[model samples]
Target: MVVSLKESDFFSKNRRALAKWISAVEDRLPEGLEFLQRHYHRVGHAFRIGITGPPGGGKSTLINALLRVFRARYPEETIAVVAVDPSSHLSGGALLGDRIRMDAIGLDEGIFMRSMASRGSLGGVSEATADICDLLDIYGFDRIFIETVGIGQLELDIISLAHTNLLVLSPECGDEIQAIKSGIVELVDIFVVNKADRQGAGRMVNDLEYMLGLRVYSGEDWRPAVVSCVATGGSGEGADGVFELVEKVESHRSWLQARGRWGRKNRRNLERKLRQNLFHYLQREFDFLQPLLEQKAEEVEKKRLSFSEALEILLEEFSRQFSSSLKKRKGG
Candidate 1:
């Protein structure tokens, strides 16, 4: 059942092909890494925007509205969405699948949406999120939206993966906003107050503005902008602040471009990605050392060796084994 897809199949504008590739990547199959190795050069063209916030902040609804606005504004361009949801305890699948929530948008041919389970990652995104986004980028989507599992203050990893980061907050958050101000404030590019029709919406925005004023930007010049939105329809039935929200996001993009920081940020993202992948690669390659590690741990537990002494013995063994394997591989 594991059929190898042709290179053309990946490059062709077929949704089915893209879905297959995404599945492979998420599952961490060898084919997925091979595909990435082959076509990674096709990346860096797509603009990645990350949306994250506290639970019940309407992040999903805001993303839905933003999709509509983007589609209308740029009909010729294609868009991709990667929504990360908390994992189900039993099955480890997405608990609140965004594909269902975004069904109101229907199946627009110009848009691609995929939902992923966070898989217990504390970073608010799954380990494979960046890889999936790279696949979407190589698939030729002009814009990619990454919606994180809403874990409030701990979702700072989005800063490393996205070009523009939007932190969606709501009036309902109340005192929770104070908890977020200490950490999330520094990473966000735009602070979006959704449910702007609510009573405390204005106060929330003002409080955020005041907090921004007190913080020093260090050497950075671009101050995070605060905006309000209802994240519903554009009609009078719901406040249409999403339009302004989109404008602010675009403005941030322009600012990044004008200051020539876009490429620099992208480079940093790649560097971090490379380092993460390297760590995983080493873990997989050295899994055979687990027994030796356990033995060392037992020696330390018995007081036969100190931690440093155990570590030194383990390092010698590791070096000897690794060097022997390298010689064997070269000789063969």
Candidate 2:
């Protein structure tokens, strides 16, 4: 059975309550939607940061180091992490291996971590990721980190939810640099070259810089910064370059706020969510058209009707049935 919590109980800062709410939201429970509708005003406060990269880029270790640094830097601030892991083909469940590496930082009282299964979402983020982030934001977390499942060059969905997006790469990313130059370069605000202690790290940095030079940027545009980090070893051992990386991230954040683009980005992201919700709602409302669609498809296949004519017929039937349904609901 799903558990439900009162708004007051949720606001009282109970972590277990918060965790239960996350589960409800992920499951799309009615109470979860109700809570979101009630307290949506509490959102838009947390700074959501997205981190993505190819597999074996040391992203988990980097995040572990980041949590330590962030905790020390902002002692009073609460932090939340939503790590999206790839789902199993057989069970559709995630191993959530990232949490193991993050255990040290997870022990901090001010920090909260949740692992989510991508569940066949090719974009590297789960469908509920944005909503989960909003929940964490409403919970009054000062900062939220969304780590995507290992992704390729074109899986750039993180941009919609992230105020600042970091694409983590490593010293062995020479080929990766070439592969993602066309797509990822344009969207990323920061290119984090993790495992900077490895050989060819300097070359990778230079390569990224040279690639940046290839793009034409005006004085006002935010050019993506490439920072190298040796984010190997234990939780906090190789945090040497992370300080600079954090500084660069902060600079980008400041740039966004100074130029008045911060709010605009959030608005755009909200618009995207609205559109997605509308699409889902329409799909549910028009689900009764499935039989007609199948019949029309059969007609087309049998050459009894042209494709365009069949589609027109379906649309007309859809309009008529939709009107009838609305009238019946309205007691007409």
Which is the leading candidate under TM-score? 2
Residue 111, candidate 2: how far off, in angstroms? Answer: 0.5
RMSD of 2: 2.9
> Candidate 1 residues 172-195, lDDT tens each?
887777787466676788999899
**Steric clash count of candidate 2:** 0
| Model 1 pairs whose backbones collide | none
Error of 1 at 198 (Å): 1.7
TM-scores, each model vs. reference: 0.88, 0.88
List the pairs of residues colliding in candidate 2.
none
Under the 3 Å rule for N, CA and C atoms, how many clashes does model 1 have?
Answer: 0
lDDT of 1 at 89: 86
Q: What is the lDDT of residue 104 in candidate 1?
A: 34
Query: How well is each residue in 1-332 modelled by candidate 2, as lDDT tens digits?
Result: 64667777778999999989998888788889888888899899999899998887878888888888888888999999999888988876677754876764656899998988888776877777888999999999999999988865535568778999999988776688878856668789999889888899999999999999899999989998999888754435456688888888789889989999899989988887777666656676689999989998999999999999998998898789878878996899
